[model samples]
Target: MAESRSETLRVAWHGGDRFEIQIRGHSVRVDEPKDFGGSDTGPTATELFVGSLAACVADCAERYLHRCQLPAGVTVTARYDLGLQPARLSKVALDVEAPGLPEGLRESFTAVIRHCPVHNTLFRAPEVTFHVLTSGHEAVCHHP
Candidate 1:
């Protein structure tokens, strides 16, 4: 039998291009166009995407180090290349810096990065499904 996976995140939009994101039942506010936004102030959507990738990797690294009972400190800096003609995410580069860690632990941490969910998901190009409901009508869109 396969192991079960379950988690839920909810997002609701407030007035004026502001949104509330609920992750595992906790609420966070996010907005766009910094000049007239809340919570994150003025972080663009694309910036947030890159931030998520870095955060995901860092989270996994931290967990792996803790599990191995190794003292490690990791910091990741991610840069995105968005200079394509059609305006798509061209490349993502990450700089991982670890200080005060055992020698072998660094190699093990590198392995953990390969298995990080965000890294795996990005490489797989998983399908996305969108649902729209308006005026008692519903529409679904699937991308493969």
Candidate 2:
């Protein structure tokens, strides 16, 4: 059997329906509906997805601004509208505010936005597969 390129995350129930996720040396506590086997505290999975998107965009914007020799005070604000029923993401908007930037820097920044990994991934649909692992089981799969 071959090892998988993807990473494995371990999750354990802390108490009162809250779960602790161990990934990349970080521990994240997550909970959900009180009756749905989770605590009423913390954001839901869908909300977390949007949160990840926002964080990725912010990181990209900050890195781009730093690489472009911009000032130290650059900020990005992002918001999203989620659709009901199907629970799909409807729209995502971003506002960039930077001080001490040259006159035509907005265009350069917009160009960088097009290359953001999260934005690109959201726009493109990639194949996704799920595997259930037991106590000492391993699953290997390839992604094209």
* Highest-lDDT candidate: 1
TM-scores for every candidate against the unseen true structure: 0.74, 0.70
Q: What is the lDDT, from 0 to 100, of the residue 45 in candidate 2?
A: 64
Model 1 segments more than 4 A misplaced: 34-42, 83-86, 137-144
50: Cα error in model 2, Å: 1.8
lDDT of 1: 0.77
Cα-based lDDT for every prediction:
0.77, 0.73
List, residue by residue over 16-120, the lDDT tens digit for candidate 2: 767777899998777888777777777666667777776776677677778977775656676888788877988878776767567787787777766676677
Q: Which stretches of model 2 miss by more than 4 angstroms?
A: 1-5, 13-17, 33-40, 133-144
Clash pairs, model 1 backbone: 34-42
TM-score of 2: 0.70
